[model samples]
Target chain A: MDVETLALVQQLYGAQSHYIDEGHAREWAATFTPDGEFHSPSYPAPVAGTEALTKFAADFARQDGVTRHVLTNVHVTPAAGGLTVRAYLQIVRTLPGGPPELLRQTTITDDLVRHAGTWRIRRRTVRRDDMKENR
Target chain B: MDVETLALVQQLYGAQSHYIDEGHAREWAATFTPDGEFHSPSYPAPVAGTEALTKFAADFARQDGVTRHVLTNVHVTPAAGGLTVRAYLQIVRTLPGGPPELLRQTTITDDLVRHAGTWRIRRRTVRRDDMKENR
Candidate 1:
């Protein structure tokens, strides 16, 4: 991938992280396409569509406190649709009366489309690894 | 990073994925540097060094079945010592009596160095998102 594409992917990741951390569920949901699919290995079913995703985010926001989502090892490939990006993420969640928990260690596989010149998630599947009990 | 570097990163991901899925734990563990640290957010402590990582992988190999790990959105930047790469991954694991599980969706952050002219992971950290119970 070129530098520009890499930068754009990073920007999209940053936006998603910001929305999630800031408790802007609606905005976070808007990061995807109208008929987007958000798949997480932990979830029984894939969260489909922008509206549904928005609602899910809203509910998730009711949790105790802040979270820091770190993205690394981002790989982007040019595709007919737009860009296929894969990233490994580390999410640290700090809740009330507890220390920050290393919530997940997994990879994000996503198909992003450029809508009006901005990258948005068209399909996302999250794979989780090493699920351990918190101390 | 240039094409050569990007290709190298992809190769590394493929190697790790192959070893993990095929139960070649010791070989998989050798992909890292001697003092390497494998950090998964879900784990309380990072898996350190080549030997320890090998043992850990060997144990993990006793699990059920085959897995397909897909890597996308790979971004690589030139670092002082070697290269830093970030990628999102989707790992699909299929066991004997169950359907394929999207094991994890996360980002992989790693520092890689050229040892004997070949890239090896010096350190790696995995972050996960959206944990849902499997059906």
Candidate 2:
């Protein structure tokens, strides 16, 4: 990872969390490629493409709660036509007038590609901490 | 981050966890610089130096419980003669015959320096998820 590439990925990760947490669904969706996919055990199936991703973001925003997605221990590797990145994700949630609480802990692996000089997530899969499967 | 530097950091992160989890305390301590420091709210004071780090590792092993330190969302930045790395840390624990449970969620920042062509942590500070301090 060159300095530029590492910086780009760091910015993308930060912006995604900021946009979603701040209710900027469209911006959050834009962080992904047009055909990006998001998967989690909590969802019945994978959410594919920007349109669906935007819908998911909108739904999450409608809940009108505070969410902080903290990521750490990130590792990056070069892939066929893109890069593979893995990190731990910690989601803290707070309801109206309530203290923040630990909501979810998952390990996230993302496939990202450079498009028009910017890196965008092409696929993101999240596995819970207690999952039987290994990353 | 050059590719080589990134890979070296990633390998160091992975190896540290594997060594500690496998009861290889000495190997785990070797992941740090001779003067590395580990700090957390759980500790009365920072554990400094490789010798102290080995002692800490030994204490963790004596607990006789299974622990998995999962890291993610790592960000790396160049600093004075070293790199500053930050990431999320999730610790899962399991007792004999018991299922795994979420033990701790923390944000960790590490200062790593290259010594003899190898990257080693010189300082690692951990902040709990519920802490008032912002990473």
Candidate 3:
């Protein structure tokens, strides 16, 4: 991948993590293309577009406080239409009246496109490897 | 990152998914450097080295029939000593006792290095997004 594109990906991810950690769930959802697709293997089905993405994050905001998502091991490839990326991530959630714990950890594969002079996620899928809860 | 290094990252991830789908868990572990670390946010701790990686996979061998791990949306950047990558992933696990279900989905971020002329994963972390299970 080109250096500029690669750099953009890093910046995109950094923004994502920042948005999630700051609890601006709606802004986080806006980082995607208008018709983007978000799928987590753990979720029953894919959530499409910015609206659904916003709704998904909003749901999390209800039960959790101070969530941190860390992304690393990024792999990017140039595809016919856009850039495809694979990354490993770890998420720690600290909820009210509970100790901080790892909520989920998995791999995220995403397809991103540069539109209107900015990179936006077009498709995203998450795969969970291991999980534990302190409930 | 240099083209060669970026290419290596893509190759490494492809190989990882291949090993997982093919059920060659041991071989999968060998793709890491001697002192590599594998941490899935879902998992409590990181699995270190080839030996530990192998043991972790062997544990999975007892339960599931076939598992598919798909990595995409790869982003890679050159660091001072190695390259860092982030990608999204989707995993489908099928067991003998039940229909195929989406067990876990997350993102994986990894740190990789070129050791002995081949790229090996040095560190890996996963973050789970969503999941659904069919009993």
Candidate 4:
């Protein structure tokens, strides 16, 4: 029943990875809803809405080197208004003339809804493995 | 077309990750064909056949830290007899008192075949991102 939905979810995630890794800030933010929420302990505060999300992506792109945002162990579940997707995310970064470093590891839970004939994240909650206060 | 096949492939990989991370050595190796092959630059020698593959997995379980084997950016292509799966592989490790470290990042190409009513890797080649001598 959700065969196609599963595929669409995977496609969106693949695109999200590319958008952030390549510094496509606006494109990355566009993956989320206009008032999407992003909550994480790593950030100074929870970022929500379109404008802030765009700025967050832009700021993330100012790193000193290459960054690969990898997602794995994905699971999708049907929800009331949309779909719920959860996956493990790893942030690997490589500095200039240095080796790639495993910067962060976390779990991302996203509530997705249909927007503009495609999937858009309505809210995303990230729980870092190293941090114990995800709640 | 490949909707079901891709899901099966993803499930197999997810199982593989757990088999290794949880130190189920034999179970991990069993995901490979009886005469499967695994070639990687990190290992001193290429491992092939059931006996060798089982041994390789067993040896890997002796690490002094916890390791997470992550696979992302998966792409599956239909093959003449089976399927070809390619993805980026990341190894994250954390010692008893240290933070998680990105140990290795590589590309893995696998030739998969149905064995005993389940998909099994017939051959796997790992190309480390830091190594250019993949040829």
Every prediction: chain A TM-score: 0.86, 0.93, 0.85, 0.95
Give TM per candidate.
Answer: 0.53, 0.65, 0.53, 0.63
> How high a TM-score does candidate 3 get?
0.53
Report candidate 1's fraction of native contacts.
0.00
Model 2, residue A52: distance off in Å is: 0.5
Best model number under TM-score: 2
Q: Name the runs in model 1 displaced over 4 angstroms.
A: A130-135, B1-135
Give the interface RMSD of each candidate: 8.8, 5.3, 8.7, 3.2
Of 2 and 4, the candidate ahead on lDDT is: 4
The docking category that best describes candidate 4 is incorrect
Report the Cα lDDT for residue A87, model 3. 70
The positional error of residue B52 in candidate 1, measured at the CA in angstroms, is 18
Write the residue-wise lDDT of candidate 3 on B1-135 in tens digits.
567676566657755775655467888888888898987766678899889888887776555455556577889987768888888777655444334445677887788887988878888877778533211
Question: What does candidate 2's lDDT look like per residue over B69-107, in tens digits?
Answer: 877677889999899998887787655444556778899
Per-residue lDDT for B14-129 in model 4, tens only?
Answer: 55875776578898899899999999999888999989988888888787766778777788898978999999888887664457887889999999999998789999999998
lDDT, candidate 1, A33-73, per-residue tens = 89989988667788999889998888777877877776655
Compared with the true structure, what per-residue lDDT tens digits does model 2 show for residues A1-135? 565676677678867888887878889989889999998886899999889999998888787578888765565668999999877667788989998876656668899998767999999998764454522
**Candidates 3 and 4: which is better by lDDT?**
4
Q: lDDT of model 1 at residue A68?
A: 75
Q: Give lDDT per model, in order.
A: 0.74, 0.78, 0.73, 0.83
The docking quality of candidate 1, as DockQ, is 0.07
Instruction: Sort by lDDT, best first.
Output: 4, 2, 1, 3
Candidate 4: pairs in clash: none
